[model samples]
Target chain A: MTSRLTVVYGVRASASEIKARAQAIAVEQSVEMPLSAIHDGSILSDIVGQVRAIDDRGNGAFDVTIDLAAATIGSDAGQLINMLFGNTSLHDDVVLSSAILPSEMLSAFGGPSHGLSGLRERVGAKGRAMTCSALKPQGLGAEDLGKLAFELTMGGLDFIKDDHGLADQSYSPFVDRVRVCAAAVRKASERTGHPTRYAPSLSGSYTDMERQLGLAREEGLDVALIAPMLAGPSNFSALRRNHPDFAFLAHPTMTGARVSPVLFAQLFRLFGADASIFPNYGGRFGYSLLTCKAIAAGLLGSFGGLAASVPAPAGGMSLDRTPELLDCYGEDVMLLIGGGLLSAPRERLAAEAGRFVRAVADHCYPRLSTP
Target chain B: MTSRLTVVYGVRASASEIKARAQAIAVEQSVEMPLSAIHDGSILSDIVGQVRAIDDRGNGAFDVTIDLAAATIGSDAGQLINMLFGNTSLHDDVVLSSAILPSEMLSAFGGPSHGLSGLRERVGAKGRAMTCSALKPQGLGAEDLGKLAFELTMGGLDFIKDDHGLADQSYSPFVDRVRVCAAAVRKASERTGHPTRYAPSLSGSYTDMERQLGLAREEGLDVALIAPMLAGPSNFSALRRNHPDFAFLAHPTMTGARVSPVLFAQLFRLFGADASIFPNYGGRFGYSLLTCKAIAAGLLGSFGGLAASVPAPAGGMSLDRTPELLDCYGEDVMLLIGGGLLSAPRERLAAEAGRFVRAVADHCYPRLSTP
Candidate 1:
């Protein structure tokens, strides 16, 4: 029997039109031609996507579940995405809701090399949620950004990452920036007596990223930030396979256009992201509270025995909302506060970061009190 | 003086809200923080994105233009995209309408190594529009797919490309498929006395694609198809630079969700696609006729003295509507008919393909008729 993966798409169509629409999607995704044109019976039966079920969710919305041949994926990460949403993404009415991949496929992908527990161990966080902050203002020099990183690290945050906007610009080349930030974080970690990790954003071509990773490794860095959508999914997966020791913090840049945040969290984890960052509810972006919860669940939930990835709720996150965020996401999360902390005076920056970190540490889970 | 690129965004906001919204976007995309946080005067003046102009297009729509520092992009293709649409793509109301890049940036990108004229030269088609078709229903084995390639080549088509869905599936491994199909196209080309180029769809990691390209080179294939989005923009740009002699036909799969099709055409050309394929107006996808024309123009128009790429209007294109397509796209386009020809019986496939080729060849330009 041919191995298959189930893909679910939320489609907008009336009850009278849904069946044909679902069938058309199956044919369009798989065969790319009419069924009558196919001569081979095996090709028709096995290769073509089979519509497993359709749930009418009322209000012109229907859930379409399709079983696609797993053989079609063939250990290629980009191809897997292409097969799932390549053509269908063109249709505005359809949203790729979820997928159920076979264990073999998950094994091939090797979900996460260093997942939630590994991340927790890296930061030396015993029980409470981890605290993370970003080094921002893209045009800043390497030394200046390093100073900011040092402040954030000194404040006792577990992770201080480069803003996704920071690339190999003349103002702050990747090499110079990585060296300074890593060293600064190390010095601060020694002073604070806490394990603080620096994650420099990885950009450019595969080769450029490889060289950057090498430089980062030289600085004793074990964590890195990457916008998987910008780097390309295949490149991200390949980088993960090549560097098993490094923990990847997946950024949500350029991702909102195609896949749902919930599905993206799962895919990022499968592609070896230790933590997946998303725009939290009541943030700069428009992701709803329900969608944010779903995204967190998708990252932390069990699937094919893969290690759980930590959900990093971010985008306009503030120090004041730490309890609420912790209440929403619980202990297995990374609360990323960027501009919220950086808005403080230069001398008070570390104190602001410390306050943010302490809040996460002190917050008691509402779930514990509910029972 | 810092070099800057002008980016245009279409925002959904009322007249009263447009100015603040535009100002917020400028700061959000650049400093990513409130102006009050930054003490540096230079950063405030130069680094932060400047709101160049905002036009209230009426009905809760406004076209906002902002100038961003070009230094933020470095020399990376992926970084360029990230800078342009990364975080902003998360906003559903904002569409990245277009961008005006500095000449230096365009020069760095080096649009289309083997472009429109080069593609026409390769296929031995002069003056008239080219005819192209895709090998479909992707499950067929290498030998069987090669047979279809032979039939299509025998029909006098200028280009025969593998369907975007066809990857390194076990049924037709990349090496086996490329070898058989290349040989079949060569055989048919010799018999028909017309050079028909075969473009094998490239899918995989950057390394995998590189290996596939090498294999294709060994098979004497001069042109290849790649979905730049799937390969990653940086990888695609690097591939073009690495293989300057090979012509790349870009496939628009998984593109519709983010950037406009018109902008994508220009970006693809700048990233070195010899031909850019998009879904036609009356096709399986929902691109409007006006959008299709704009896409064609974006590909063919002169930009920073870069070579023009051929616009390929595809997706459910048929032989019967060949005249209308030609009239709309003119001679600078590739009329790609895929499943429409494949829907014919097995024996009549070549004859149907021949009819498609003939329809393009025999059509009279409405512009010429007016003269």
Candidate 2:
């Protein structure tokens, strides 16, 4: 029997038309043609997707579960996504909600080489949630961005990442930016006695990213921020495999509207993201509190003996809400406040950063409370 | 002065909130921080996204145009997408409608190494719409698929492509499938006295794809199919740059719901798709006739001295509708009939495919049609 993985999709259709829709999705996602056209008995029995279950959610929505052959994927990450949601994504009425991967598929993916615990060890955070910020407002020169990185490091933040916008632009070439920021973080760490990590955003082709990674490694940087959606899931997987020592923070860019956030977090972690960053509830974006909790749970939940990934909630997050965010997310999280910390006066930026770090540290978790 | 590109987004908001929402999108996409925090003179003057126009489309909908600095893109296809819709994609209320790319930005991308004319020359097709079909129902072995390819070639189709689902699966590995299919097409072409290009689907990491291309070249196959969205835009661009002799058929998978299909066609062509395949109107997907026309126009229209890409309309297309489709798309298109021919009995499959070819060949395009 072929190894199978289960995938669930939230489909919008009337009750009467749901069975055909679910079956159509199963065929559309797998054989992609009439089942009678398939001549091979093994192919018919094993390869064609089987609709496992369909539960109506009312208001023109239903949850559909499908079982697909693992042989069709063959340890290829890109093909896995292609099999999971490639052609089906074309149907506007369907949303890929979740999946239950077989053990072999999970083993093939090899989630998080350096996950939450590894990240904590790198930053030396014992029992408190991590504090993080971003270097933003694109077109800044390397020296200027380095100065900002220095202040954030001085304020004892665990991670200072490059804004996803920062790439190999002429104004602040990737090499120059990494060199200066690495040195600045190292210099500040020597004084503050905190091992704050600086994660530069990666861009360009897979080869370009490899070259960038070489430069980052030369600068003694281990953590790197990458948008898996922008880089392609296969490239991200390849990078992770090639650089086992490097911890990755997956940026939720170009992906938010494509798939469910919970599924994305799970996939990112499985693809080797030590931390997955996303827009928090009541932020600039539209993810609700319930969705945020699910994303966090998906990342931190147990799955196929893989390490847990740190969920970094961000996007227009403020220092004032740090306690509430921590209370909701618990301790295995990274509170990323970007514009909120940057909004402080230039002279008082480090103080504001310190306050963010302190806010997370001072927050007490409510006993037996569900986020 | 910084070179700028204009990106238009369709926003879902009230008339009263359109201005603020548009401005917020500008700031969020460019800086990802509050404008007050950016004190750099050049950054404020040049790097910040400027709202150029906003037109109300009624019923809480508006078209908003924002000009972003071209320098931020930095000659990187992935970063170009990141700058265009990365963070904004997180906002459910927004949809990327189109972009007016700067010439330099256009030059950097360098659309389609071997576009429509080049592809037409390869198959010796002239003065008529090209005929194409996909080898589908993915679980067949290499030899079985090869036999199908031979039959399709015997039918005198212009192009035969691998189904997007036919990846490097264990059931039919890419190398074996490509080798067999290539040989089969060659054999059938010798007998039929017509050139039928075989386009194997490309998948896996960049390095893996490069190796696959090498294998394809060895088998004397000049055309290959790829999903730019699945491969990552930068990797696709790099592949085009690295292999100037090859023709690419861009598959619209994992991309349909994210951006406007018209914009997707333009972007795919810009990233080097000789033929951009999309769901035709009245097909399995939900694209309307107007949207399909716009997609075709975007692919065929003059843009920055780039070669025109053939818009291949596919998905649940049939032989009977060939004349109607020909009238809708004209001679500058590739009419793809997949399952329509495959549904025929094994004995009549070639005859059905021949009928499909004849349908396109016999149909006369309407005079001065818009599509």
iRMSD values, candidates in order: 1.5, 1.3
RMSD of 2: 2.1
Residue B338 lDDT in candidate 1 = 89
Q: Distance (Å) between predicted and true CA of A324, model 2?
A: 1.4
Over A78-123, each residue of candidate 1 has an lDDT whose tens digit, in order, gives 8898889888888878988888898899988988899999999998
lDDT of each residue in A1-371, candidate 2, tens digit only? 77898999999999999999999999988988878777778888999999999998889999999999888888778888888999888787898899889998888899998899999999999788999999987988999999999999999999999999999999999999999999999999999999999999999999999999999999999999999988889999999999998999999898847578899889999888999998899998889999999999999988888899999999888899987988899899999999999988778988899988888888887777678
TM-score of chain B, per candidate? 0.96, 0.97
How well does candidate 1 match the true structure in TM-score terms? 0.97
In angstroms, how far off is A183's CA in candidate 1? Answer: 1.5
Clashing pairs in 2: none
Model 2 misplaced stretches (Cα beyond 4 Å) = A368-371, B368-371
Q: What is the interface RMSD of candidate 1, in Å?
A: 1.5
DockQ of each: 0.72, 0.73
Error of 1 at B348 (Å): 1.7
